[model samples]
Target chain A: MSDSTHPDGYVLQAYHDGELNDEATARIETHCRDCVRCRNELAELQRLDGLLADIDAPELPRPVWPALNGALRKQHEARLGPAFAFSAAAVCAAGITIGILLGPVGKSDQSSTNGTTWEGPSSMWSGGASASLLEIHLSDMD
Target chain B: MTGMTDDQLMIRGAAGDEAALRTLIERWEKPVFAFLVRMLGSPEEAEDLCQDTFMRLISSSGRYRPEGRFQSWLFRIAGNLARSRLRRRKILRWLPLTSGHHETPAPGLDPLNALAAGQEQERVRAAIRQLPDRQRQALILKRYNELSYQEIAEAMGISVGSVQMLLHRAMSALKRDLSRGRHES
Candidate 1:
């Protein structure tokens, strides 16, 4: 295999594939004209090429677009559509969270300004002692 | 619409043109499916992957770069998807309980006449399948897809010289296998 007639089947294969430049193609053309072994090898390569090329493509199934179209449209919508929906949902959630959070802060601020006040939900403090402790802390901070 | 080039269609698709996307699918569905079917050797899987390929195209249209030929880009995506599927198949082949191997009859083949024709086709496919992955890909892109060596290089992420060498080696191996099969038969 190493000591074949042609040193490199490179040019031969290239020529067979028509990958060679015009000048190189001409050179191989001339070489192949006189060389029996190279010609035979070239023929074998061509036969292989033909066999590959002849592998038939399967008949395509009917247009798959109904599902594909739905999928693509869904994908397109997923890409373009969900983004707005996501942001809108995010904004609404943020608004609710902020309102809930700020409701406590707003009540705390109004009550805290009056000094020594416990103005949160009554459920937060279990005993009178706890309420008094919280009042003292609030008064100290104020 | 029909006269629009693929690139033009892609650009329109990128711009949110549904009609352009439809036209693009109509234009490329068969060719892409054919490429996938041959590459994967399973019509059912190929059909599924074919749809995925277009879905990917549509999804990625926003980032579409028209620097290269659209056909080459499309095949590059298909080639990548096929490679991933092959890798999955390789992993699945090892599992004991899984019936992972499915050989779809070659398209247009009638089971009655397929006895003879199918064997030959399967022989060629088997020989091709026996090739190292890159070599098989180089050969398929060049021979089956009719892509030039350069396009094959682009699609396979290799050099033109590598593409040439891969094809040469692939052909050499196929010739040996086919000749041996001929003798055996």
Candidate 2:
């Protein structure tokens, strides 16, 4: 662009994307019609974009259906009402089960809570739930 | 299935054709997922988010206008999801790509040994990731989505001038990077 022309990179991008208006596009085309450097640069950018087209997508995960399945099942389930209750109930059940399992595992060393040996990774692994996750769950409960 | 355009597919999808919906999803899922993966640098996250976009589409069946292009609509939803993720992080997560290998060879070079497409893809991905977010957006929209400047501007909520400037700057940076490749071994 000349001194009087637009200094904005956006206008140039518009030109590159072929989004410029007729007269403006005509003007830029005219410029490229004469300037070898600008023409070469344009050619180079096109080449780079072509090179970029070589970038293929990442690997698709296995069992991609689960996510899509949930979405699909929920399609009609929402109209029936209380459909999400099972998920909530499952969480509560799991919470209670985890508490029971951990309570026994922690006291297994004492041989008093079911008189079993503690052959676990340690008390740290006993808390299946992370502290933050526990706090978040408790906070939600409250 | 055979005669349907994208808009028709969306309309059919809206009318509860699971197959039509699946077809639509199949058509655009890869590119949108790729867009998200590159943007957020997490394939797992992108997969989750891509599923969410489709979920929204399926659930919002009645809301789509019959007149709009399904591709644009799908992209608008994806763009919104991407924008929300960006806003929450206020950061870029650039995953390196690994798929730029030439099948035969560089036709012009005719070298003895072929360059690995994976490494070339990685280099380009890294260079793109280093770009400022807006420039990256412009470049991705044009180069990946193949949207015109006006469409990209509309999608990005910017002017044509801004899009041009972003592309100009991005190409300049890319040119410099490409030149560096020449200077190295």
Candidate 3:
């Protein structure tokens, strides 16, 4: 069974932060007075906190800041030129591709083999491609 | 005094103010680098991520809403990146540091007494490095950055209850490690 009265987790947390008000503090202090295990755990944590703060921060070499600045500046420049951006180009390219693929359907005799596959546009290109596949099938059937 | 307020720097930075950006770098570079270096396990990778973190901040200037503290937001970013890096490496959740010197240096310890303090800081650092990712993150966020338990949970995307458990486990682990170290010495 868990230690229901003074479950160690939150008590240590509160004690370390100095967040406990006087009454809660008094209760914990009273408990620590008697409980060896809890007192030992709390003391270790306090010591650990002191040790960690003493460590020095790492120092970076001088040029790295300029390098970071250069990168940020470059990104900013790319963002500034929206018209020439690749995302914009991608959208335009996708629109054109979609238009070509879906712009015209069966309203005109554009794709049929028997119909006047459009005069100037010459439906022959599309029809020829389909006919080539059909020719292979016919030969195979024969 | 070393850097402008988070909101001030962010606003100026969004306006393309280079000086404001540099001020931020000067202020946050060490703690940020320290966290990344310890988490990523390489000074080189830490530096790269540090640069990348600032670059992101630069690009995302106005995106920082006034409601959130910049430090917490920045830490959340670091925590996310660190987690992804660990996950990508398929890391094992190793046992944490059982004991060592405190996370913070005791403020009142006289400089002359540094030697007698019997502290081997590298031992503590290595121990921290060995902690399971979540526990280490929780401990570092709490001790080094002085984040509240709720803030740590928020930064790490864990529940506050989970944060408490992780810290408790971490404390126990560190205590055990320290006792072992003490006995050996």
The per-model lDDT (C-alpha) reads 0.72, 0.66, 0.67
lDDT of 1 by residue, A1-142 (tens): 1353453676677788888889878877777788898889998988887776655666567786678765644454344444445554576699678778898766655654465443423211122224433333334334
Residue B101's lDDT in candidate 3: 22
DockQ metric for all predictions = 0.18, 0.20, 0.14
lDDT of 2 by residue, B63-129 (tens): 8887655565666677778768767877644444432223455456434434665457667877887
TM-score against native, each model:
0.72, 0.67, 0.66
Q: Per-residue lDDT tens digits of candidate 1, residues B94-149?
A: 21211123245557878866676656766777788777768877777777677888
Cα TM-score of candidate 3: 0.66
Give the best candidate by TM-score: 1
lDDT of 3 by residue, B1-185 (tens): 24458778777767766667677777888778777766766667677888878777776776877555788778888888887888887866542232222344556877656544526665676667767888988888887778888788778878877887888787777767766777887
Q: Is the docking of candidate 2 incorrect, acceptable, medium or high quality?
A: incorrect
Candidate 3 lDDT, A1-142, residue by residue in tens: 1375564566666776775669878878887788887777677678877777756555553434678855644554444445334444565588678667876753364455464321212121132233332333223335
